[model samples]
Target chain A: MSLTTDDVNKIAYLARLGINAKDTASYTENLSDMLKLVEQMSSIDTDNVTPMAHPLDTIQRLRPDKIIEDNQRDHFQSIAPQTEEGLYLVPKVLD
Target chain B: MTMHTKTLKQLSQGLQTGEYSSQELTLAYLNRIQQYSALNSFISVTEAQAIAAAKQADALLTAGNAPLLTGIPMAHKDIFCTQGVKTSCGSKMLDNFIAPYNATVVDNLNAAGMVSLGKLNMDEFAMGSSNETSFYGTAYNPWADNTVPGGSSGGSAAAVAARLIPAATGTDTGGSIRQPAAFCGITGLKPTYGRVSRYGMIAYASSLDQGGPMTQTAEDAALMLQAMAGFDPKDSTSAQQDVPNYSTNLNNSLQDLKIGLPKEFFDEGLNNDMATAIETAVNEYKQMGAEIIEVSMPHLKLAIPAYYVIAPAECSANLQRMDGVRFGHRCDNPEDLNDLYIRSRGEGFGTEVKRRILVGTYALSAGYYDAHYIKAQKIRRLITEDFTKALESVDVIMGPVTPTPAFGIGEKTADPIEMYLADIYTIAINLAGLPAMSIPAGFIDNKPVGLQIIGNYFAEAKLLNVAHQYQQVTNWHQQTPKGFE
Candidate 1:
């Protein structure tokens, strides 16, 4: 039920976030407290119970394979940090 | 009387009778927003755009073709995207982001002819109970200085309470709408999940997120709901059911109405003053020929834990789009793709946001997936079943909106678990996907408390009727903070 320092690092890395070096100890404590809260669910045994993913319990609605969305690439890219020739510019993925 | 004190219906009639033009009314509210700038209620006031919209509305009025809300001025909770306007979800991450298109709710309000005053302030990513987490600043409660206008819809509630604007739009994933309404002494309704479109509204937790109205009276709330509700194919989760005219049954008699008081809501954690005020309000329901019965929702206490898991999990996935390369805040320089994402998200999100993303990531992480996430989902089913069974016997369930009246700003920030408990009363209804409301019930030590009414799924009209009948006899909702008047 407790999150060690390493756990916080791994979780933050998995979430693609960099934890402030100075705030790591505080993050560890906070996440540990939250886990304590979440751990309360262990009191009840929910074996064989159906997991509810939606409030209404309805299946995802399906539509035919067709493109109904209008292309707004230019408008969308207008707010991007880096875009060139209609492609979003990102750092190199490979050396 | 000055225009700000009038309700939406009153303002609508004024526009129809030519007593006041939309421009005049909009100008009055704009000035009031300026007057109360110390309240930190509004994030952006689109002065030129509001004036232009007012002029067009006046032309419609002159031609005898004005809609119900043609000239009325209100604001959004900043979470809803508005075209060409900044849609900061109270975060530094989206501080520079401008939405290219309007959210469905925004478009709906525009089509209804409601002139938007501007965007309101809120907790970053709708994560916190108090507005202190806002990147801009906290919104002060108009009722009492230093007290929080309970959030994440804190600004909307305070603005309406101060008569700066008649009403505004607010979203509730948990208690974001109802809790603030209770604290600010206004009427707010969170309709059944999917009752309103979420196409342009920023996502918090998709399954639990819903948009509703924050107004002074249930009638005004009904009028706002009429404009904002209905099906939108764009939102896959939007209800396919039709939105009934919410205002049509405002006068429905409460005779023989079966009301249930959930015993769990009145337990030890509730403030004594809150209990006294809620019960006194229930007595008024009895006076109106309604019957009250006690009901128990045993799994009620599980809501907060279940929510911490589900909400953050959903938020983690939803907020993953905030990478440096796209629409939101980006880092200065990136060594590589991983560096861009890490620094951008790290520097972009606030502490509370980072904590949630971390919690959510851990919950959905490889080893802990079934034990944490699945266990929480099964617990969600139990809590939903509790509400379903309780509602089968009662017309509606009544309770206090919060454990106590609004707390002083920065009161519960240090301890996050203590802050999470503020949602104890309001979170379960969302788990059930039922429509619920919070109407001004009474005051405690000069602070306001709201009476919560939870109804069966899609019972917005009945909830409004119940709240409207109470407003008929009591004048609590009519009480305005002294200095503001």
Candidate 2:
């Protein structure tokens, strides 16, 4: 499963990386080589195998879903690139 | 005394006796930093803050209130968050990012009264094996200026090896700590997955990323580990177990202990020099009354494939928090919402980072998830089971840390596959989520070979004892890189 140029463009778009057509050839080549290497898993017999998510196979202990801590919205927003009215401001999407 | 040559014990002893103030020790290291600027080991040095903390520690000591590690100077890999300090993680994404809080390990170390030397350089987001991927610059091996220092913890290993600091903290995802320590001729350990809290330590692969110590000897690693390990409520994955006295078992004899030699680890592609050094070290253990047995880990071949998928897949999600909006570098021109994402990420991330994000995106993309991402997770279980079987027969597993000694700068940079192959021996340990260490076993062609000692989960104390006993009988750990002295 080699990545086509269209696939590279779509992946870059999803990843939010600005990969243009000029560099798509190189990206395609590199991604394909890496995928080829990763593709070795296809030959393995994993029919009865269960996927292990955590290193230690244990269910995560969850804390009660409660807002115990105070929200320092103003303090946190002080470091944002562009924030106004306690909201992160980006370019207008609908406009 | 130079503080660089002094072990943690010696530094602690000096602090207790009032031989020199913590300020003086920090100054000694700072002076060394100025002298060894060519090595490019440190990313940021908080001279004023370090001195102020040292002075405060001295006051506490004079008032008969000193902790176990009062005033000892050490540095952290830039990956660990330090309150109000710029924790760059050696990437441009967080170049201007000042962490609002200290990582759990940093808070614990500060509580123990250790002084922060600075933030050490590392590969960008702790991704690459060599420090070459760092946005700041590549870290030079103080041992041989021409060769590369192994990464992504190259800066910490180089700093310790060059005697710039007594010890430093490092993170090992896939041999980031051990390989660098091997190349720089020092001691480095990666504790079991949950042994150390990852809270505030920037996540690479949450499951595999473990914070440990890189020091001059196994004893120093034990002392440092005492402060680093603990369960933290903030990090959900942190184990809620008591951290044992790692130093207490330092004097335990390795006699009658069983060491496992994995047949696959010693097979083809294993460099003759590294193989010889490992075998010689095993023979030394035998002479010391230890039994060696052959072990097998059949899933070894799938480790790199499994790791590439799982690590990148996790990394993609982990790094999403680094977008331009929060804090750090942001692009000037933005066309729209999509442009903001593209421009910010493109300008912020380094080449290796972008490469990983691309690979990760494809793996987790629609129609390919089962073939790549999920299958890798399935194989991860097989690798862990292999270790469990191996450990049932032996006290610890021993092998070479890397196939070859440190290579020259730009030697394999152009060929990414070649560079990835360098991490083959170390990645398996991360896959199994086991505790492992790289101790200076012997030298090959004037370069050092690290004898990797791996233990089952939560077996750091046993691994340290094995390395410590080896150090007692052998002087290999004492060898310093040339010109460092």
Q: Which one is best on DockQ?
A: 1
What residue pairs clash in candidate 2, if any at all? none
CA error at residue B340 for candidate 2, angstroms:
0.3
Give candidate 2's TM-score: 0.98
**lDDT of residue B64 for candidate 2:** 78
Q: How close is every model to the real structure, measured as TM-score?
A: 0.99, 0.98
Q: How many backbone clashes does candidate 1 have?
A: 1
Candidate 2: list runs displaced more than 4 Å. Answer: A65-68
Lowest summed-lDDT stretch of 10 residues in model 1 chain A? A54-63
Q: Global CA lDDT of candidate 2, please? A: 0.90
| Predicted candidate 1 versus true structure: per-residue lDDT over B367-405, tens digit per residue | 899989999999999999998998999999999999999
Residue-level lDDT tens digits of model 2 in B1-485: 65678899888998999999998998989889878988999999989899999999999888876987999999999999998889999998898888877999999999999999899999999999889999989989987757888999999999998888989999999999999999988999999998999999999988899999999999999999999999898898898789999999999987899999999898888999889999999999999899999999888888888888989889998888877887777789788888888889888998788888889888898988998888999998888899999999999999999999999989988877678877888998998889999999888788878999999989899999999999999987777777878
